[model samples]
Target chain A: MNKRVGKQTIETPSKPRIIATASIVGPKEGEGPLKDYFDIILEDDLNGKDTYEKAESSMMYTAVNEVIKKANFKEENIDYLLAGDLLNQLTSACFAAKDMDIPFIGLFGACSTMTESLAMGSLMIDGGYANHVIAATSSHFSSAERQFRFPLEYGSQRPPTAQWTVTGSGAMLLGREGNFPYISYVTMGKVKDYGVNDVNNMGEAMAPAAVDTIAQHLRDTGRTPDYYDIIATGDLGKVGKRITKELLLEHGFELKDNYIDCGDEIFEHERQKTNSGGSGCGCSAVVDCGYIYKNMLNGKFKRVLLVSTGALLSSTSCFQGLNIPGIAHAVAVEI
Target chain B: MNKRVGKQTIETPSKPRIIATASIVGPKEGEGPLKDYFDIILEDDLNGKDTYEKAESSMMYTAVNEVIKKANFKEENIDYLLAGDLLNQLTSACFAAKDMDIPFIGLFGACSTMTESLAMGSLMIDGGYANHVIAATSSHFSSAERQFRFPLEYGSQRPPTAQWTVTGSGAMLLGREGNFPYISYVTMGKVKDYGVNDVNNMGEAMAPAAVDTIAQHLRDTGRTPDYYDIIATGDLGKVGKRITKELLLEHGFELKDNYIDCGDEIFEHERQKTNSGGSGCGCSAVVDCGYIYKNMLNGKFKRVLLVSTGALLSSTSCFQGLNIPGIAHAVAVEI
Candidate 1:
């Protein structure tokens, strides 16, 4: 039975295993530092699709198929597909689910969707509700830019605080038991808003949420930062990562050298000209499913904590001058 | 233990109970047939908020607070808040969560979100991950119109098949044990597309998915349609409800007089001047939480199957000339 550990954390005694994983990225992300980690790197962002939205859906579909294939499981073997993406009404996930033919549970947590799906999937497995489930998410640079920011054709100059949206998709298959790394605990997060209104500075907006969830996770699990080999925050970039470190310090928890941000690690920031670094639903997804999963299997990391952060704002909300509220969900995985 | 009954259904033996429910509606909905069943009815749709989006968020916030209050539980006593709405990036749900201070899991199934949240919340309670959870959803006609269709200011011509978006909010509090109606089973849905491209005719688009889930649920649980006192679909409006009846007949499961559509029951069609009927996330939400919950408590309904249907389409996808896909999640409740 799954145990409610503390205020926010749930301890999954059954330890749902990550049976298989796959990641696919666009041309720009392929040129980044984690290039060798991804399973497939597209030559172009559009991938022969007429629209960027279709391209995003195609990438997610490919990743789902790849993960199932890696697990040697037929499509019917999967019990559920929990997926979300940074799209209006989750268009990409819905389109991908249409092709997959699995029982679908649609989610929307902005960029935090990866860990959100992971936490829910783990709960379903640990509770004996399902034997196999897939968690997946995707985001496209061009599609996000047009929806959230200026259109690419306008050549709008972005501020230094702006982060580049990652064009990629990642899929992870979880099972009741396996030799692979297992999900041990999950920490659900509350929305945290520090009244940050700048749309370009999502890092600043989401940092408080990252700090809240991470600190709450540590407190609930009764573990220090040193307990894990690595504590990774999803897509906080340089600016948000620094803010998280400072805020977490104020919360009486000091994140040391073991801490990392997927946004900061995914790209060669200065060389790649990714101003603040990579950010999107795809940022943490690709990094965790590709680089982190591979390293965990290789025995390079025994235990890891992944906190995927999301800035809950829309173009409409931003235009209405509403404050951007941030949220983060943390999942602990161990080998 | 939760048992996977068949392909899509899960038998929740623990039977998570609906401890309390609250429904709030706008002026138009307040004038509807089920108006007296709602907890609160606003004189105006805006509810004094400047923007329609904020008004929608405010309604959801009120519904959450009202539900908790009705249950005699404090905000902190609620373990999780699962919510979604019809907006870009789920603006209403995020903003509502920001004010609630509870662990939030954002979901997006378009109008089907009410049942989706309920299914997830019930699973959480039955799975031992949470003791008490709130499942909620909201939709405002003006906000949805501006987001999905033309703005109200445009005075766009509507087809006879077009359904009027409902302006309301509903919230249900689910606990591990209680004397109230309990969720006995849940059937997760898959995306179903019949190549329906007409944006105005959403009812026809979603009927196939509704029929698919209802039939699958009955087959998985080894029950006939007569097992439920009432089997309700979320927002199939007039057009979709007829289509659903015909399709289910073809599937060898005849939906008799016990079948109802929340959208169809919401308003007095021709008198209300609602083209097809009322529709939105709030349509099924208010009907179920208000009319259905109250009736169940009064021994009017011993069993109910709510299959919330959603058209998984965005304005972007519609503009791209893509076909609209549909999904429906069914939660069986019994006293």
Candidate 2:
């Protein structure tokens, strides 16, 4: 059976199961609406570490370990660890991976790392590359701010379009044979540049890519929006969420009943003062692992489309006046 | 049929073929001994670009396009493009990927990205995920120096142990069916930290990882060093090459013959003034794609073990006094 469908999608002949998942967040995200769903909520963003980078690494280490523990497996049992973070050279992920004995592959999809890891893990399992793989990602608000934008000590005022970088980590353990939410299909995305260069407006930059991937997935799978109980985009905030909806509608598909943006829902915009909403790799990661996965297990949703969007640009590129390019990968999960 | 042999290795049931490969390098690399093997050699390191980052991106874009053309496939025929670079957030790779319409998966294995991409690309093809995939990576001396160490304007004298980052790019097109070098097996790597904190001596930091992966590959495949015509490590340079050989000897495996390090062979040490020799993601990449792959086609080597080593550490981690973690992945290529 040819697993590939249409152009950029792959339908797994043997669905890859998400055996277990874990999420860790800082006090800010813990105060969010989905606080009860997170496994570990830190009292401080630094988590007692000397630096924010070290703290982020510690969080990721905990998330990876927690996910493996929840799967009832030891460190040695995991065949591979696919992970990444927003920091330069994926500092958090590489540092966290150093503590584990699992063979590791480092990925970088910015915020889309959550679904990128999930999609790659699923493909690896279904392709017989591994029986079990751990997909994880982490992000720290302080670290990201210093690296991507302004320094924490600078006390810069963010634009209304700016999204808060979530300080958290998420991990999912995937297996070939398991009774869990099965990854059925994957739609890989092409880099799309909509001529948006403002780093502060990542949501606007990434929204088109989210819509592009969702539409491609739908077309490839021959399914309508109704086929999925929930349609989720990773970190596209309120502005990007609305833009995605409008783009979908323009394509003759309306996401009327089931639509969610992880960034938009992670926090209360007015109360939390997170500008547009939560962002970063951990934004969508914790939402999917802590909230969505839990609800799927509870039978609240039987089918879901996860479109994890990423704005792929560096500070150097932005400084060099290059347009921000966005990419989004979609994964179809069924219970 | 199980494909997986032993703990950390995967033996492809249907060996994926390297249908086509391309390499582009700067003037210094072109002046090297293996210059004859490279496809395109730029007259200058800048390659007429405003910045070294853009130059690196252009080199990668050209390499990818050339490989696809050599493979007799159009841009749309490519199923996926797996690429990365040493820059923060993989700017060169992501920027280069913007020109292509193929679905892109950005990876980061540092210098090991060359073999890591090949391993994943091979698995995707053998696992029936895609008929064709392209693995590519790039690195520029000026760009990597500015990002990882001092600015080019700093003009600080390099230590004797330091290696010159290669200014080059390499791309390989893998297909399910093709008359090319067959990818027979892959040995994934575990992150190994030896408490080496000196970011300048990446060779020493990454040597142990190369030895570890090579030992695991031998153990997993149940093969002796004699099985392979060439056992190569990517960008480990003279220091790392010696350390790797010494470590392998301590592990009861003697690479008595047919052992090579891509970094050691890429440049003429004395003439090039590259103290410890060439090092970077592109060092191994261009060597593998241009020199080794071409020689293999000409029957100079039958079976080879290509192990690409990486010292996974960010400048922030180094500044914060963290030990460098090393990783190396191996792929078996046969005629």
Candidate 3:
């Protein structure tokens, strides 16, 4: 009955089903490789809103509505909506939830919010606290750049290590009475800081945390890399992916063969000019909901370990010369 | 098996206990009426930190560690740490959790974080997800003022309606094995916006939301105001408390005698010069942990309803001229 498996993993006994999922991306992402997998593609990042922040909120609202439509359920059917975004105070998610009229719990895990919400939603359903829960997150390129980096009008040049923030949103509905792929396990993560302070290279900053969670998951669950058909990490771009693989190998878990970073899969690096890769709350969100979830439905993957990584550094903390702490949450899904 | 009551409340069949708690307050709060109740009263708000942000982080760290110590448990004994603060990106909570090495889940409910964390932690325990969970939140007057209002050096004058943000942190350790006050039910709230846009008068903006959740909780549980010995609203302050009481009376529930606002209990309004009383993430946190929890332990109150209200408007949203939305989550506790 003790669902906690070693240090940081929770073994889900009920295996709460992921009933439906939907992803919405901006025009840039629509032109990317996995464009067809997305449910809605915006021709403009603004999405008819005046500010990029409102545009991000619109994307979240759209994704939540689309996922509910896909599940053929009414808004009243959702018992709780757990959501978060990269914006300060989670403006996008909170604004979106305000219109939904559902019970809301705002979360903040930076880019890892997608998986954090999913893990919490699964537990809510599995624990019989709710019949259905919607977990959603969003990020916007312009909004994030303005908030975390520089002003949009500044047109400042970025270094090659900088990862482009993805403009998109993803929502997943979890329910107890579904025959869809179910979340089998969830591994929570501790804050791990490797003393990296460069805000520009978030991929490198988050890499070690992903490594820690990945190794911890395998060790706690007593599973090898081969046990999972695919192990996907959130937003650890090309640079971080290499570091993650090395660290996992150092930790004695050879995770290279079956592992893939969501950021690396989002765009064609050479042509898209997404220097390192896509990075944000939305980077891994759209990939997981559009690519991985769809593939699982098609029987392309039997088991998957989706670890969403986050850099827990605020602009204030960066300004104060604090080290960037990173965290990664892993959820095991089986069809 | 259905834990959900009429509409919004979750009736926990397996009640979760508040095993131990600790509160740390700044110099100002230490001079307040509830001074004797707080565990740690700092001689100065800075507490040897250069920045007020780091000072808030130190307060959070001290409260979390003190709560663990009070419970006679090490950091490893805690399965998860759920924390938040008024700082952007939850800098206080994240920085505190980084040093603890516990699995962290950062939440953002603005000022409602105290009850939000308590609700989530209780569900985690009752659901058999974890045996022990720590819920903590903090807010510093200087840090919150700089982020949400004027900078410390600005020395801007505030309106009479403006409330002072409390400088303090509170942590509660929830477990399944303790004989502490049990969490009996939780009511997750829906965002309610009455089109109030003034960031300066957050109490007025959040009042309707506290009314909505309190009424929904009473309706769903089929209980009257007198069903509990006390009903405490988080940080509605004097302005919000008055509005909330009127709104609840309009909804056919006259909650005048037994209801109290935590914001009203902290500082003496006239003597402390906190115009509209205390209002922040820390306002209700220290009040609940230090005063209410201590009183409950002494058998002063058998049953209570704690509703923590929040105004979910970021500085960005306010700058963008968006209306403020409010939410209030309620928890039923019984000794």
Candidate 4:
């Protein structure tokens, strides 16, 4: 187990560790054309419309398959599967986990699910429960829009801080440490509510939470930005990332070289009109399962910090003028 | 880890395990009332006009507090939390988990989340990852009703198969071993679509999934109904339970002395009101947490099978002409 740096030490299992991770999404929404496991499927009758469940499930299905293939295993070898998505019942993640035929466990943490899954899965491996564990998450715009915001056809003006729903999914595999890089550390994002009432622009509303989590990780680890090659937040696009940078400077620390955000990275190519950035579990997941995995495998970047974030507020709470509480988790991996 | 009937196969990390579980709904909306937890915060004039999110936040806040207190746990000692509720992005669960200041991993399994959480948490203990993991789930009538079917005040006519939501929350602790019983074996429920076209009543929609999972569990373990004191399902309600019983008999098994369904259990007080039975993750959860936990601690029942079921289709999917797929998970606990 890794030693503590600051107030409390974070320990990962010596037994069970995540060995591989993967993800997939629609062709048009994907970062690249061929960087997907299965062919991108879009139904004709539903123009530019996809259910959060479908978008989430299809990608999750692909991710699970990728992790399985990477490990060179069949369906039954996996003892259990843990998954969740941006649905009321975690249908996409759970349903996909079920079909995959692994003993399945489901979870939901809104956009922060991927990190949470990693934490649980990592702990499992550390504790020596099993040799392998899989975690995944996904989301879609069509499903979330109607359920959380408005009807599918409703054309409401989005607030500048409002983030576009990420249309994607990501998956990972954990096993005994051997050849692959291991998750050295994980810190959960503290729930910070600046009491900002306007969720139309989530980046501004969530910036403080992201900042707090990063700051805490730094304080807890007693490490500066030089400790890793890059620090990537789950979502938080340009505006949010800028605010985070500004906040970091205010605290007497700076991360100028590569303090990037995952949502901004994933949506860089498939720019769906949005003021701030993309937000969802898929933001980090897609990037992790896709770009991040490829890069790490290709020996592009070593020692990276992936801090996924989530906004904890529902439609009812939003309607009641409750402030959005944001949380993030930092996962450190070294090549 | 505990060994099953036939294999005599041993687990790597030896300890108690989480097995056969159940979740079922009663009349109250999402989950049933807990004896120790405060009475459901009835929506009155002050909160009556609250939005789905508002009522949900309030109820969730109250329920979580009660769950923590009842579990006799100080928030800090909780190594990790597994929680999920029915809402877009799991806003309610996230908000609560954040405020609790307990590092948590949120999850979503729709109504089957209770079982899913149990399965994952149990695996953690069985695999030697944790000594304590709390699995919790909740649902609210206003929240679910508004999101899927109608507004809280819609007062629409009820369908025959529409199971009542049991406005409640259920939580339990998974550990290496306890004075009370421990989760014995966890059998995952598969995503089975029986092609049932009925949507108005969830019993019709989810019955097949429950049956399939329970059948698979028995088949996989090679155990018979005579092995357990009870064979309970999460929230199939009266209608769904009846169908499940019929299916089980058709499979040449009879749970003669000790087979009671959770949905049917909660409604024993007000049979007429419960009508068919409970439906929702909280349905089975509340029963398990409020009723079953106490009984097991008191040594009323020894061996039991808890199978929580879920229908993985959403209102939009139904409208989109997609069939509702369902899943169930069974965890057995022995005192």
Candidate 5:
């Protein structure tokens, strides 16, 4: 029986010209979760909307404003503002854009926001619409804790497979032409329901979803993992990593050497105690903007596939008895 | 010094594909603010969020779930969940996507979210990264009011330039070869900062930003508004609309016949007591998915530019005495 691969083709005469890409983090990289690149800090205060809202808004607001300030390109050059955050309304990014003298368009892609925004921004550029696009997102412990998990002072112990949200902000400049990567290729993962049926252990829940998308990407592009200097998934913790490796090998493909997960690389130190890695829109973003982009500039990696992953689940859904489904999009960053 | 325009080129061996797009609303035709689409029985208790926390999330949850249900695309087939909303952290979109069991990528484009999502989803499809992508955003009167204006029950009269947030949802199936009009082109508006120093009136504040981008699009694509059956901008209200018209004429281009603004179209009947036109991410979205799309399919229109407008601003910024800026993105829907 011949099964359909579920593919469709259309002629889209669009070329998104990336104007630029930028990023910001707390004072220290991985030293403090909340200190990645935030200009404003919450001193362990777990205030409800009172503190969390401002902190979240402030960090994203700062990063976006800074990127705009540093662009050298007039704010008038920016055609649309595409931004997202780990928080609810994407308030920080949205509000920050709102406060600016320039107008905007916002987005939400969890830790993969920058990529999402860039993907869209590139569309506008490719389609011969606008010349400049700004994509941004932020993550904060104080803000994310209250929204995604517990309050800041809740002191919830994370499982070894658990990941940390980076206290950082990433912004990219995509113009008709600039130093930014031209979004060489993009591959989206099908939403996969691994049916792990374990919310408490996200690794088991999301690992298969990650593997399926990664494997599909290789198949679709007809390129081996060896083609990329780094084949990075957005965030898959320790257990997910174990499973991803195993699944890749089972499929007659091996990527033990150059395949790196953003979470694992960002929080590799014992001090972080993040046995799995760092997760969140900021996690993969910081690595992408701060680490990966820099590495590409230095010619350390020639071709890279950035696979940002997101888990679809909410507190209510968890309460309503739902399994975690995961999806990923792969962006090929080439020299 | 010579200012040179740069080029961001997209080179691919093959054409990229689209996965899907979805939309929901109250009425199918003729815009009339919130009353048209949603089965909105104006209740004194009608609120966007139950509390400040729930305001954004609940609205996003409603739209996301509605799209998921309507699309009938199983969550497992959805590789990437792209969403954005007006709340901080993109709470509603994020929270909504979190529960659906698909990996999520959040977005924030203030009012231009729906178009922004489409652009990104199209890129993922074109890039052949993922098989499917979901893009959505929502705004509730109660939710946005509390965050950006007075409380949900604020009896204060709205300003003429204050457009109502459509209490509805929209989604689309943007597959590579779907029957729906392909998101063939996307023209980004230049981030123009004409420095409109108005906070209370978004229409006037956003007019220049709209004109700047729209005019540039004509130049970039070298197509007159006559090239499209319908040339529409999202929510530029009555005041901004006239100026946009004037600006176009000044640029030797006029979209007199098929030109329309989502704000003017949605608030046509509400003129007696309207401040601005309709606002929020769903304004253009509801129109696109509901009226524009259907009209295009029915032969009332052929090539249409769904220009979604956005005012990037926040309550905090307004409180801090900052001016309101605007933006718009044009999505070409071809039959």
Candidate 6:
């Protein structure tokens, strides 16, 4: 019954199913290609909230509640709620959880939080620690902009390498029994830094970590790239996606057309005026929970590998002239 | 085999042992009551680092290395490194993990991180996800002061209700086998907000959460206050500790002299001029890793409950007029 595989990947023989999923997005994301897949779309980014932080929390709360409702389960049915966000101190996730009565564990993996929570939730179900668990995360463009870079009011000019932060939230409920796509393996990532210090270039900072985890997962499971219908990375936008493909090829893994980056898929780059692509915890979260999950149910994808990447940097760390450290966690789902 | 008890408590029947522990503290903490119990005490808080943030990361790195050394295990032997801190984006943990090759999972429970990490680590071992895992956390007074409150150079006067942020790091290694105290159960806490808005009074903000988790653990396990040799609340200080006692009493649980707060135990209140007491992620972490773990091995205590409380607030949230939300996670250790 030992679930650990090789060095870092964990095999979930019990195959905890993704019983329910919900995604909520702002107006901009609602106009994206995956618009029809989302559960809720806000007319305004603030959603009548006073601040962007509160809006982010509201989005996450809606996603969590919607997911539970979708599963036909009350709040009390959930044994544990594992959540995180990009905000400092995880304000969004914590505030969202405050309204719920479930036991909570807050996580911080930057953008990788989507997979981090999913992996932990799966482990809880596979390990017999709980029957139902909710894994969730959120990110808001205005909130992240003010915290990490320039405020939206400042109207700072973005470089070509800069990516748009998605204003959205995603929640997935994992249960002991379901006929949906189930989590079969999880590859925990290591902190990987390649001395990338440009705050504007998150893609470059996070690419190596994505490649590292993806390669590790394939190696640990002894599976070829063809084993998965699609290999998706969390938020490594255009620049990082290209780097990830090259680096993965160097690792003897050919990431062909089957490979995609959530950041790259989240928005219409040119039409949306997103320089690189959509980037944030929400980018991958909404993509996976909406498009990916729905497609799997429709028999489009039999197997999928989700590698959520995160750049572990803060304004303080950047001010201190430290390089950004990146991390990526992978969760394998199969029908 | 379900392991989950009544509502929130998850029993670890496999009993993952605390095989190794190490604590490193700043000069101020080295002068405290449990100074002799720590593995390493620094003469300077900065430890030759340019910034206090780096100092915190270095201390945590030292603690992780020391614990691994104490356990006679190589870096590869440890399956996972679960760590967090009070810093934004968990910079200290990420930088520390950057040096080590272990798979990392970043967590953010504010000060409750120690027990949060411990709970997750215990679950990992109990669930057969990994053979070994490390739970660690750190905080630095200078770094936290500037980030959460005023800059140290501001020489801002602290009120009696304000607790001192501890400058230290603590790491513990949990494994499948050992002749030491093992984690028996973990009671996950819910985010509880009581409309306490004072930024300086963390104890008052976190007290209700501490009480809730403690009472829930007792109710779920069908245990009385006397079931534990000592019940410790992490960094609740004097004000919060008193509130916790009163609240628990209202819940029909009378915590007698067996109750202790890590915040109160760390520093000599009057002598150290730490108005309320030491309060930070390091407060409970260093105490448990240095004093409690060592004492347990020496048969000085039989069963202990470590409840680490956290006030989830940031400068942004506080500025936005949001109330501080508190959370507490408990891990029961028995010899």
Per-candidate interface DockQ score: 0.81, 0.78, 0.84, 0.31, 0.18, 0.88
Q: Global lDDT for candidate 3? A: 0.92
Best by DockQ: 6
lDDT of the structure predicted as candidate 1: 0.94
Stretches > 4 Å off in candidate 1: none
Which regions of candidate 6 are displaced past 4 Å? none
List the lowest-lDDT window of 10 residues for candidate 5 chain A.
A1-10
Chain A vs. true chain A, TM-score per candidate? 0.99, 0.99, 0.99, 0.88, 0.85, 0.99
Q: B1-335, model 4: which lDDT tens digit per residue?
A: 22332221112233353322222222343223343332343534124535545555445555656555655666665555677776666665666675776656666667888877776676655654455667778776666777777776768877666666666666666666446577666666556666775666677667777777676677767778888877778888778877877877887776565766676666543534656776666777877765676567667777888887777766656766767777787777777
Question: What lDDT does the true structure give each of the candidates?
Answer: 0.94, 0.92, 0.92, 0.66, 0.61, 0.94
Query: What would the per-residue lDDT of candidate 5 be over residues B1-335, giving only the tens digit for each residue?
Result: 11112221122212332233344443312235434443222232233334533434554555555555556766666656666666644545655664566655566666777776776666566554456666677665556666677776757776655666665556654545446566655554434455665655777776776777667666756678888889878777778788889887887888686888876776554543556667677677767766676676667887887777777665554554545656676666676
Model 1 Cα displacement at B161 (Å)? 0.8
All candidates: CA RMSD in angstroms? 0.8, 0.9, 0.9, 4.7, 7.5, 0.7
Per-residue lDDT of B318 in model 3 = 96
Comparing candidate 3 with candidate 4, which one achieves the higher TM-score? 3
Q: Give the proportion of true interface contacts each model preserves, from 0 to 1.
A: 0.89, 0.73, 0.82, 0.41, 0.27, 0.87
- Model 3: DockQ vs. true structure: 0.84
For model 2, how does the per-residue alpha-carbon lDDT over A1-335 read when each residue is reduced to its tens digit? 35789998998878899999999999999999999999999998889999999999999999999998888899989999999988999999999999889999999888889999999999888888898999999999999999989878889998999999999999999997758999999998988889999889999999988988999999989999999999999998988999999999998889976999999999999999998888899998999999999999999999999888899988899899999999999999999
* Ten-residue stretch with the least lDDT total in model 4 chain B: B1-10
For model 6, residues B1-335, the per-residue Cα lDDT tens digits are 58889989999998999999999999999999999889999999998999999999999999999999999999999999999999999989999999999999999999999999999999999989999999999999999999999878879998999999999999999998868899999999999999999988999999999999999999999999999999999998999999999999999999999999999999999999998889999999999998898899899999999999999999889999999989999999999
Q: What is the lDDT of residue B161 in candidate 5?
A: 59
Candidates' interface RMSDs, in order?
1.3, 1.2, 0.9, 4.6, 8.7, 0.8
Candidate 1 global TM-score? 0.99
Clashing pairs in 3: none
Instruction: Write model 2 residue lDDT over B1-335, tens digit each, in one string.
Output: 35678999999878899999999999999999999999999998989899999999999999999999998889999999999999989999998888889999989999999999999998889888888999999999999999989988989898888999999999999987757899999998999999888877889999989998999999999999989999989988899889998999998999876999999999999988898889999999999999999999999989999999898988899999999989999999998
